[model samples]
Target: MSAQPPTPPHMTVDEFLVWASERPGRHELINGEVVSQSAERAAHWKVKLAVHVALLNAVRAGGLNCHVVPDGATVRIDDATAYEPNALVYCGEEAAPSALTVDNPVIIVEVLSPSTGRMDRARKLADYFRLPSLAHYLIVDSNEPLVIHHRRQEGCDILTRIIREGATLLDPPGLEVVVAEIYGAS
Candidate 1:
């Protein structure tokens, strides 16, 4: 008898979720491949935590029906196209493809990195704009104390990052953030 070739492994979101649920790490699905996403570096993680806490406080104070998403939560564009944005804010629960395939998120943030900078600025920007609910995209530099926010407008061209607070961080419309609060600590 002739031996057959090895069978390729395949898993659905549900299956992957079950298997990954037992593990103590973050991961994502991109183009049918289960790619393991890495944790942020110590400095980056510190900044991320600080920003998340600030945003959470602001979001809560506003009494808005929104939730701050943790990093590594998958956002599916299509069956084959998915991305785990660094941070995302959704007005209502966007957690179900059982109900909705696309999430109309208002904001998407990606902490800039050396490797992902070009991809985030170019490819990800175009991909993210496909969402009508997307009002702002914040590209934050990990090495520098800067944030470049791209906000959409009704008639005129979208507002680019005009808020250069130097060490002061500024949060514009749709979201409220204290400049000094985030950057002042470290």
Candidate 2:
């Protein structure tokens, strides 16, 4: 196999954003460092598309203020931080003027691939919690058709629920995915 070109050592969020926007691979900024994701394999795309399809349908049907984005947006958290979660629900009013950084989002979903599973399940979950409006952080595993998450509880944050492949609940907009969908055609 040919050697992949070397990526720059690091980049400021703005520089990284500009650079990523100009190119094609999946990339996200964390603490002033630019991290590029591997080109997803077929299985990876399957799970991502499955969940996004569910979310998109529900959000649109509900007529909710939130917007559904596929490969959504890269939000600038601060000069030193920016991230683009795979699928995010940006709820609430988008007033006449809004800032680049969305301090709140009702939900954020990170579908895991072999290369990114660890960070997405831990480091990334922690960051998502920092958003006050983040009520649900869904970690959809490609290997297992499961929606694991830290769901907000009755007045508190808790990892209280596991929406397995067979279950369905209406957080809002009312869409459901059978865990089997995540496992693909196995």
Tell me, by lDDT, which candidate is best. Answer: 2
Residue 13, candidate 1: Cα error in Å is 7.6
- For candidate 2, lDDT tens digit of each residue in 92-181? 676234233455667778888888889987787777776666777788877666788677666655664676656455474344545655
Highest TM-score: give the candidate number: 2
- Which residue pairs show backbone clashes in model 1? 169-179
What lDDT does candidate 2 reach at residue 103?
55
Give the TM-scores of the predictions, in the order they appear: 0.71, 0.77
lDDT at 87 for candidate 2? 77
Q: What local distance difference test score does each model get?
A: 0.63, 0.69
Clashes of 2: 1
